[model samples]
Target: MEEAADGDWVVRPITGAATGKTYRCPGCDQEIRPGTPHVVAWPAYVRDSDLDPWDVDSAADRRRHWHTACWRSRDRRR
Candidate 1:
């Protein structure tokens, strides 16, 4: 987990699980293939001077799975 410009990013790499369920990448609106290696990212707990921690955490809960490329390109879009 690390502090990110947008939010605290907690990123994890997943592999070798044949979970048949598919996840949609919010970055690209495409289905993440079953058992495919990818990134699962979320916001880390943050202590802000001017913001509520719970609000930041709740928004982090909305974190979505993303293709490696898509996630890496996140900053470029902005």
Candidate 2:
């Protein structure tokens, strides 16, 4: 893991919506805690619609990181 800068680690939302570092999760309809595990649903990147780690036009670019259970659920849905 890269060293977190002084202003780097924040409890902001992952999506680009909301001002500053706050965002609402589309999956759980709740706020995202930086230190906790939260579920997020993101659209595929425009370039490769099947790829993960997509760039968003929000406050921050949203990327995909699948937990073990989340990964399994994703596979089953495919």
Best by lDDT: 1
Kindly give the stretch of ten consecutive residues in candidate 2 with the minimal lDDT sum. 1-10
Question: What is the C-alpha lDDT profile of model 1 across 1-78, one tens digit per residue?
Answer: 856678778887777384467999878889998988788887675446325535553536656788888888887866
Report the C-alpha displacement of residue 41, candidate 2, in angstroms.
Answer: 5.4
Using all chains and alpha carbons, the TM-scores for the candidates as numbered come to 0.70, 0.25
lDDT against true structure, model 2: 0.36
lDDT, candidates in the order shown = 0.74, 0.36
Q: After superposing candidate 1 on the true structure, give the runs of residues whose Cα lies further than 4 Å from its correct spot.
A: 16-18, 46-60
Q: List the residue pairs that clash in candidate 1.
A: none
